[model samples]
Target chain A: MSVLIFAELDEGALKKSSLEAIYYGSKVAALTGTSTTAIVLGEGNADELAKAGRFGATKVLHASDAQLNEGNAMAYASVVAEAANQEGADVIVLAKSSLADSMAARLAGKLKAGLAANVIELPDVSSGFRVKRSIFTGKAFAFTELTAEKKILAIKKNTITPEETEATATVEAFKPALNDTDFAVKVTNVEKATGDILLPEADLVVSAGRGLKGPENWGIVEDLAKALHAATACSKPVSDLDWRPHHEHVGQTGIKISPNLYIACGISGAIQHLAGVNSSKVIVVINKDPEAPFFKSADYGIVGDVFEVLPRLTKAVQEL
Target chain B: MKILVCVTSVPDTITKITLTDNNTKLNKAGVQFITGPYDDYALSRAVELKEQLGGTVTVLNVGESDADPVIRKCLAIGADDAIRVNAEPTDAYFVAEQIAAIAKENSYDLILMGRESIDYNGGQVHGIVGEMLGLPSISPVMKLAVEGTTAKITREIEGGHEELEAGLPLVLGCQEPIAEWKIPNMRGIMSARTKPLKVVEATGKDTLTHITNYELPPARGACKMIPASEAETLIKLLRTEAKVI
Candidate 1:
């Protein structure tokens, strides 16, 4: 049973979450005594995708199709299904990003395979494949058993650390038969954050809530985040108030993240908010109110004004 | 025009999550159940589209009879009718098949569901249903507007968002800001009791996946407080002690 990793590219660079998927898929392949393969699609840099060999992918298949530059779910699913058949892959892995998840859904239907999304761990494939996944917005976990010959798995972000090995992969090009109808929905325009790190892949995150006062005072949070090289986030209320983009909202109704270090400022931590970031390795809370519920869950608490403390913290990190 | 919105009853966001029965199932004791928050956007949009296009909005659920109250709430919120498939949804594939079969029978103009459920986090049903019915499916759509038989959708891609257009007989997995949630009024609540609710047996078979058990996440450790004046000390701890910075 060969393992296949679907590495989705973000503006020519591989998504950081894809690296984690490759690392995890390769380990699963090794556990099952099979070679690992990665399928690269769209207008991504082939050399970068081939770097998956360092993460345990022994083979990389790149489909350099201009028509697939703006990927469509149905078309990509068909292409991935063909590649999986060609590679003799019984298990397919993908990063649980929104687009890959969309494609994964179509791929499951096309392959008539069972799919388990938001998987956090590899399966015990010695018998039937059994894996663990987060449910209820990371408040609890569910162990799922997939009793199927062919299965598709989407790995949640930050679940696995990439281990780079000394290896080079043989990059090969493969093409699948596709038609204009495959591009059912034509993309008209795109808006992006350009160079900013994606929230899901950030190792360090600097988040704020209403405690920051208003959008005008966000400069301090941005300054501290810049000093620490972390992605920015906000509470649900902040997003609801339009203080930040909806994508940056972190809570039960927003993006669930598990960064290595999460620094929350001025945010009164609600259970819905905690549901998103509780999985972080270390949490630091800075708020004026010491009784804030977030402080109870924090690894370190500092009772102070974010306005005064943020500048000092930024300067201190720079001095170090 | 006919529209169907899929609603899921999930544990409320504030529910204290726990495990029961040897950690094989969720402990429902004292838990409050509500319609999935994301799905509220889809349901509200369905009701809005129904009002504008002079059509009927129907709510669909794959759950036991206990879910009837939730369906009625959705009806009160503005749906014209409801359909409850009498079965416990095991996985996305099982639920999608039931939806696809129902849609095939009804031939609705549009089918909408939340991008994902808060409980399972499986955002697979919309795409599976679309593929099964051979229709166009767009997910994570933030903005949707209909004109005649075409629908303009704003969907999120990796690191960016895109605007796309597709024809009717489509599936949309909705997210935030697509449509504001609408609350049920006293008049609507009273009318919901008289609205028609059709209960049908599930027609799909469970495939490929089953939950073996469930477990609560480990509890957090006690927090350690630090002085507000010690910025340099905290930075030092983050570096040498935490080794994270």
Candidate 2:
């Protein structure tokens, strides 16, 4: 039996989440006493996929197709399902990011396999493949077992730390049958933000709310984030008021993040907003109002005007 | 064009999560259930689209009898009819199987659902159903428009966004940028009582994933406060004590 992992790539480079998946897939392969192979869609450097061997992959299947450059959920799912069938893979793994979840679910249905999504821990293969996942907005955990012959799993991002080992894996080119309908959804244009850290992938996050007063005072938050090498985020109200872009908004109505550390400045945490960041390992809240709801959930709290507190914090971080 | 929008009942966002003594089941004493927020967006968007395109809109909920109130609420909001799968939602896989069965028997032109249910947040149903029925699935969609048999959608990417075009027989996982939610009017609420709500037993595969138990996260530490005047000191503290900076 072989384990097949879907390696995600953007503009021909592997994403960090894909690396994490490779690590988890490698472990599963080791536990099952099976070989691990990686399948990449579109044009990716074979050398990069082969490097996944450090994480347990014995081979990399690079499916290079010009039409597959842009992500089409149906097409991607078809390709992965076909690759698994061709390789006789018993298990298929992917990162639980937007693209992977979308494709994994569909692939499971196509293969008539069992699916485990948002998995946070490695599987226990001694019995059946039992995986652990978060439920109810990180309020609870669920341990599940795959009962079907084929299994598909979407591993959560940043859940598993990547460990390295030395090995050289072979790279092979595979082609899947495609048609016009497979590319029905044509990506007309692509837009990317100009920043070093993407909020979803950032380990440390520095966020602000309406408490910052206005856009003019944002420099302090930005400075602190830069010094800490953290991505900047905003509450819904700030994004609604146009102080920050909607993409930077993190709340129940926005993106849900579980960074290692989340620093909130001038933000009064509402339950809706808390539902998003409650998964952070550590939370620090800075608000002038001592009774702000955010403080209740914070591991550390600072009761002060963010405008004054942020600059000082920025300077201290600069010194460090 | 007939649009079928699926909704799921989920725990309220602010509900305090607690586990049963065994750790395998959720403690439901203080938990209040509500319609999944993402489904609300899908319902509202479908209603608006039907209004503009002159079509019928139906809301489907795959859950036990307790979901009737929310299913009625969907009808009040503008859905022409409602369908409640008479079964406890075992898992995403089981739920998708039920929805796919309904879609196939009904022949819906378009299927819409929230990106994921808040309770489980698996984000799997739309894609699974699409695959089951051989349809295109677009997720985390910010913009959508229907013209004849084609749909134009804008999907959210990591840094920015990407626009795509797909034909009919498609599935869309609606998110925030779809449209503003509309509250039900008194007239609609009154008329919802008379709308037909069909409840059917679930049919298809068994759940592959089962919950072992629920666990509440550890409580947060006490808040720390620094005077507004000592902002710089707080920053220094973060650099040294907190180490975040």
The candidate maximizing DockQ is 1
| Per-candidate local distance difference test | 0.87, 0.83
Residue A304 Cα positional deviation in candidate 2, in Å, after optimal superposition: 1.3
Note the residue pairs that clash in candidate 1.
none
Fnat for the candidates in order? 0.77, 0.72
Worst 10 residues of 2 chain B by lDDT: B230-239
Please provide, for model 2 over B104-177, each residue's C-alpha lDDT reduced to its tens digit, 9 standing for 90 to 100.
88988889999989888788889888877878888988788998888888888776778888889899998876
Candidate 1's residue-wise lDDT over A142-176, tens digit each?
88988777789898877787888888777888888
Best by lDDT: 1
Q: Stretches of candidate 2 above 4 Å error?
A: B221-245
Candidate 1, A63: how far from true, in Å?
Answer: 0.6
Candidate 2: the clashing residue pairs are A301-B224, A303-B225, A312-B232, A313-B235, B23-B213, B24-B212, B24-B213
